[model samples]
Target: MTQYDVTLEWPDDGTDTVAVSPTETVLEVALREGIRLPYDCREGTCITCVGRVLAAGGDETPGAEEAVDAADAFDYRRQPKALTEDERANGYVLLCIAVPRADCRVAVGPMVRSEVGDSPWS
Candidate 1:
């Protein structure tokens, strides 16, 4: 199986590194590794698991092509209801359903926390 490197950066807890298989969601991998990321409905109906894609590949230049490529790189299996098309274009992803197609750097939003005890999911 192929694996992709995922780096999650949280405001309070700094950063965490994990490897995810193409078949696994970011949240699933994080939880399995004991990394606490905030989430409400694991079903993608909520925005609690939202994170920003700080970087994906070398396509940081903002343009239609970059946006399309970013969308193609991150697999949000279901329609991410919590995010607008503009938000999606801007690199926001719902971690509960996001499966990276390549190595990705995610900026954990303010709503997220890292420590196991600090997690609302716990």
Candidate 2:
């Protein structure tokens, strides 16, 4: 089985890197590894597991002409119901419904989604 490293950056604090397989959601691996991540519904319908895939480790400021969204790092099992297309294109992912496809870093915690406007579940 192939695995990828998913670096989870928690709010105001910690970071953990866990191995993830394309066959399972990141949350599943996180739960199995005993990694503490805030989650409620284990579905794409909620933003509880929302994470922003950072660009360039978020170390330096990105130039206005150099925006990079690493959306290809993970695949959405279902059409992401909680995120707008813009958010998806901008590297936002719902870890509960995402399967890693490549090594990626994610920003997690309360601050990440305090104002996320999700698509209405119809």
Candidate 3:
């Protein structure tokens, strides 16, 4: 199994340093760590787990799929603002669907939580 180092940032001053496996989804790890990042479908179809790649200072390894271009980002399961090709190339991984191929540093931005309206379920 490939061991990857990952860093996650949350709005509530929460952070995590975890060892990730090549087969483990980012969403799985984040949930295990109790991060408040939003998630819907655990598949790539949802963009709720999408986030920015803060740093990728390692080997250029082939990711799960070709880097998603801004246009393709929209065609996914859940519609989200398209991320620039550069962003996707530089290691932006959609947490729900992305599994690490190398050690990575990623930051989930604050806007995701801001958009969550008062939940009728809650």
Q: Between candidates 1 and 3, name the one with more favorable TM-score.
A: 1
Cα-based TM-score, every candidate: 0.78, 0.83, 0.59
Maximum-lDDT candidate: 2
The Cα error of candidate 1 at residue 90, in Å, is: 0.3
Cα lDDT tens digits, model 1, 1-122, are: 99888889877768898899889999999999999988888876767788877677654443334433337458877877766677777677889999889887777866432211122233
Residue 96 error for model 3, in Å? 0.6
Tens-place lDDT digits, model 2, residues 1-118: 8888888988766889899988998899999999977777777888888888775333334333443464667887887788887887777888998998788778898888875675
Better of 1 and 2 by TM-score: 2
Error of 1 at 32 (Å): 0.5
Clashing pairs in 1: none
Worst 10 residues of 2 by lDDT: 56-65
> For residues 1-122, what per-residue lDDT tens digits would candidate 3 score against the true structure?
55677777665656676776766766777778776667775655445566655445453343434442323211233422333345455444467766665565565765643433322222
Candidates 1 and 3 compared by lDDT, better number? 1
- Candidate 2: give its CA RMSD in angstroms: 3.2
Ranking by lDDT: 2, 1, 3
